[model samples]
Target: MYGPGDVRVEEVPDPTIDEPTDAVVRVTYASVCGSDLHPYRSMAPSQNGRRMGHEAVGVVEEVGADVTALTVGDTVIVPFSWSDNTCVYCREGFNTSCVHGGFFDGAPSATQAERLRVPQADGTAVVIPEGTDESLMPSLLTLADVYLTGYHAAYTGGVSPGKTVTVIGDGAVGLLTVLAARQVGAERIILMGRHTDRTDLGREFGADDVVPERGEEGIAKVMELTGGDGSHVVVDAVGHLPAYEQAYGVLRPGGTISRVGVPQYEEAPVGMASLFGKNATLTGGPAAQRRYLEAALPQVLAGQIQPGRVFDRRLGLDDIVEAYRLMDSREALKVLIRP
Candidate 1:
C-alpha cells in the first residue's frame, strides 16, 4: 500500500533466501484480511508500493541450510505473523509477541505475490498433510489467520461444551468464531451481525440465535436470551468502542470476553464497578497461530470446518487492488486471490 486508499500491483524483484533460517515459497493462494483495511483507511504515511497481504498457502521452493523441519516441495500455511517459535513468549502460547516475530510485508517478503521469503521457516510455517486435495486449499488457507484468530478468541474465552457463547461481529473472524465455538462444544452460539449474507453463514456455522440489533438493544436481547443472566462467554470480534461495551454489557458475572478484533480505541472505560462487580474478565490479542494450526488442520482436512466459504469473491493476484476495493466497500465478505 502506498498510502490511504491506494494499492498498486507492479513488477517487483522475486524473493530469495536472506537468512540461514529463511525459506522461499511459491504462493498458491492469498486473501485480503479485515485487519489490512486498518492501514488502508489510515491517514498514517506508508511506503509506496510496499508488498501487501499476510495470509497464504504455498509450497516450499527452497529452504536455507539451517532449516530442518521442512524441505523443498512441502506445502505449508503462511501465517499473518512470523515467529521463531522457540522464544519464551511462543513457549507460553503468545507467538504474536515473540522477540523475533514480524509481519510479512516490505522487503522481508509478502504473500500477495507469486513468491515469498519466509523467515524462521521451521517455526513460522505449518505443513499440511500430503495428498491433500487442491480444492481444500481455500479452507486450509484460513488456518493461517482468520480461523486461528477466531479459535483464539474462543480458546481464551474459555468456551467449552454447555457454555453459552456470544460472538460480536459477522466478519470472517467472527463467523469462524462461531465455527470454532461449535468445534469446542458450545451448546448455544449467539452471533451479533446485521448483514443477511453473513448471518446466514453464522447460522450454518452453528449459531443458535442471531441478534441484528446493536448497542443497548442487542445487549438486552442477549441478556433476555440467557434468562437475564447473560452469556457465559463473549467474543468481541469487532474491535470498536461500542462493540467492546456490548461485549461487556452481555457478559455474565465471572464470565470472560475474548476480543480478537484489532482494537482501534486508544482508551476504554473499564472501571471496577463495571468489571469488579461482575468479575468479568477481558482477554484477547494477536493470535498465537502456530499453537493452533496443527490442531486445527485436521478439522479442515476432514471437512468438519469450511471457513473458506467466507470468501464471497475470488480473483487472481493481478486484481488485488480491486480485491481491497471490494472489501473496503463491504461488497465482498473476503476476497481470495490466486497467484
Candidate 2:
C-alpha cells in the first residue's frame, strides 16, 4: 500500500535468489488478509510502494545452491513469515518469532504479485504432494496464514471435546476459527457476528449458534447459550476494545481467551476485574504457520476441510486495488488474487 486506501500495482523487478537458502516462487494464488485491511483503513502506517501481501501458494521457479528440500517446479505453500526453523523459538513451535524470521510486507518481494523471493526456503516453503489437485490451491493457500491463525486461536483457547467455544468477529479468520473449533472437537461453537452471509458460512463451518448482537447484548446471548455459565473458551478474532471486552465478558471463570486479531489500539483495558478476578487466561499472537501446516495440510488435501470456500471473489493481480476496496467495503468475504 502506498498509503491508507491507496494501493497501486506497478511493474517491478522480478525476484531472484539473493541468499543461498532462498528460492524464487512463481505465485499462482494469493489473497488479501484481514490484517492487511488494517493499513488500508488507516490503522497502521505503510510505506509507499511497499510489497503488500503475505499469503500465497506457488511453484518454485528457482532454488539457491544451499536449498535442499525444495527445487525448481515444486509446488509449495509459502508461509506468511520466513524462518530458519532452526532457532530456539522455531524449534519450540514459535516459527513466527524465529530469530531470522520476518513478514512479507516491506520485504524486497511479496506474494501479492506473480513472484516471491522466499528466504529460509528449506523451512518456509512446504511442498505439496505430487499430483495434488489444483482445485485445492486456495485451501492450501489459506494454510499460509488464515487457517493457521484460526487454529492457533482454537488451540490456545483450550478447545476440546465437550468444551463450548465462542468466536468473535465474522471475517474469514473468524469463520475459519469455527472450523478449527470443530476440528478440536468443541461440543458447541457460538459465533458473534451480524452479517447474514458471513454468519451463514459460520454455520457451515460448524457454528452451533450465531449471535447478531454486539456488546452486552451479545454477551448475554452467549451466556444464555452456554446455560448462563458462558463458554469454556472464547476467541477474539477481531482485535479491538469492544471485541476484546466481549471475549472477556463471555468467558467462563478460569476459561481462556485466545485472540488472533491484530490489535488496532495502543493499550488494552485489561485489569483485575476483567481478568485476574476471573482467572481468565489470555494467549494469542501472530500465528506460527509453519508449526501448524503439518496438521492442516492433510485435511485440506483429503477434502475433509475446505477453507477455500471463504473466497467469495477472485481477481487478477492487476485488479488488486478493487480487491482491497471490496474488502474494505465489506462487499466480499475474501478475495483470491491470481498472478
Candidate 3:
C-alpha cells in the first residue's frame, strides 16, 4: 500500500467459535471500505496485508451453544462492531461503544474473509428475513455498515421534518447520508461533492441540491443554498482537516454538526472558536450499528432505499490486490469480492 499496490489475498483458516456467545459465518459478499485504505497506504506504519474489509452479508454456518438469537443457515448482516446487549452502554443505546464487548478492532481476520468468527453474535448480528431476493443482497450488505453509519449521522444530527441538512463527502457513506436524511423527512439536502457521477447518484438517492467544491468555495455555495443562514444540520462524512474545517463553516447558528468519518489520527483542528461563535452543537463517533440496522431492514426489504447501488465494481477474492488499488485511487466507489 505504501508504494501504491500492496493488497494481497491468501488462504486463511476458517474461524471457529471461541466463546459461548460467538458465531461463525460464511460470508457471501464482502466490500472494501475507505477506512481500510488509510492504514494500508497512508498511515505511517503502513501495516501491510492485514485481513481487509469491514462490511459484509452472509449465512451463519455455526453458532456457539449459548447463542440463541441466530441459527445456522440464517442469512444476516454483520456490522463492523460487535457488542453484548446486556452491557450498561447497550442498555443506554450506545451499543456501538459498549465497554465489555463492542468493536472487534485491530483483528486482521475481519468480514472481508470468506468465513468470519463474530463474537457476541446474539447482540451484534441481525437476521435477514427468509425469502429475501438474492438481487437485494447488496443493499442488505450496506445495512451492515455504511447505510447504518449514515443513518447514525442523521440521527445524531437531530434530523427531523423541515430541517435543512448539509452532507460533506460523496463517497458511499456520504451518498447514503442523503438517503437517511430523506427518510427522516429533511426538507433540503445539500450534498457537497466533486464528481459528476457521485453527485448525480446523490440526487437520485435524495439530495435536493449538490455543491461541487471544497474549502471556502464550497462553503460559499452552501451559504447561498441556505439563503445565507446556513443549514440547520451539517454532517461531516469526510474527516481530513480541510473537510473538517469546511463542515464547520457551512452551518447555521445553533445548528448541529455530526461527524462520522473515522478521524485519521487522534488530533485534528476543530475550529472550536467558529463553532462556539455559531452556538452550534458537535456530535458523532463510531456508529451505533445495531440501533440503525433494525430501522434500515424494513426500508431495504421494501425497496425504499437501494443502498447497495454504491458498489460500482465487483471482483473475485483472487483479484483482491487490484481491488484495493482501484479503491485507493478512488476509481471505484465500492468494490465487492466473492471470496
Q: Quick one: best lDDT, which candidate? A: 2
Models, CA RMSD each: 1.4, 1.2, 1.8
Candidate 2 lDDT, 1-339, residue by residue in tens: 878888989988899899999999999999999999987877355555578899989999999999999979999999889999999999998998999899996687888999999999998999999899889999999999998899999987889998999999999999999999999899999999999999999999999999999999999999888889998899999988899999889989999999999878878756888988888899989997878898899999999999998999999999999999999999999999999
Candidate 3 contains a number of clashing pairs equal to 0
For model 3, residues 178-233, the per-residue Cα lDDT tens digits are 99999999989999999889889999999999999888999999999888999899
How well does candidate 2 score on lDDT at residue 3? Answer: 80
lDDT for each residue of candidate 1 in 1-339, tens digit (9 for 90 to 100): 888888888887888888989999999999999988887898466666567889989999999999999989999999998899999999999998989889885544788999999998999999988899999999999998999899999999999998999999999999999999998899899999999999999999899999999999999999999999999999999888899999989999999999999998979878876667789999999988988988889988999889888988999998988999999998999999998
CA RMSD (A), model 1: 1.4
Better of 1 and 2 by lDDT: 2
Candidate models: Cα lDDT each = 0.91, 0.92, 0.84
**Model 3 segments beyond 4 Å from truth?**
1-5, 44-49, 269-272
Between candidates 2 and 3, name the one with more favorable TM-score: 2
Error of 2 at 325 (Å): 0.7
Model 3, C-alpha of 259: deviation from truth (Å): 0.5
- Candidate 2 residues lying further than 4 Å off, grouped into runs, are 43-47
What would the TM-scores of all predictions be?
0.96, 0.98, 0.95
- For model 3, what is the alpha-carbon lDDT of residue 31? 81
- Worst window of 10 by summed lDDT in candidate 3: 1-10
By TM-score rank, best first, the candidates go 2, 1, 3
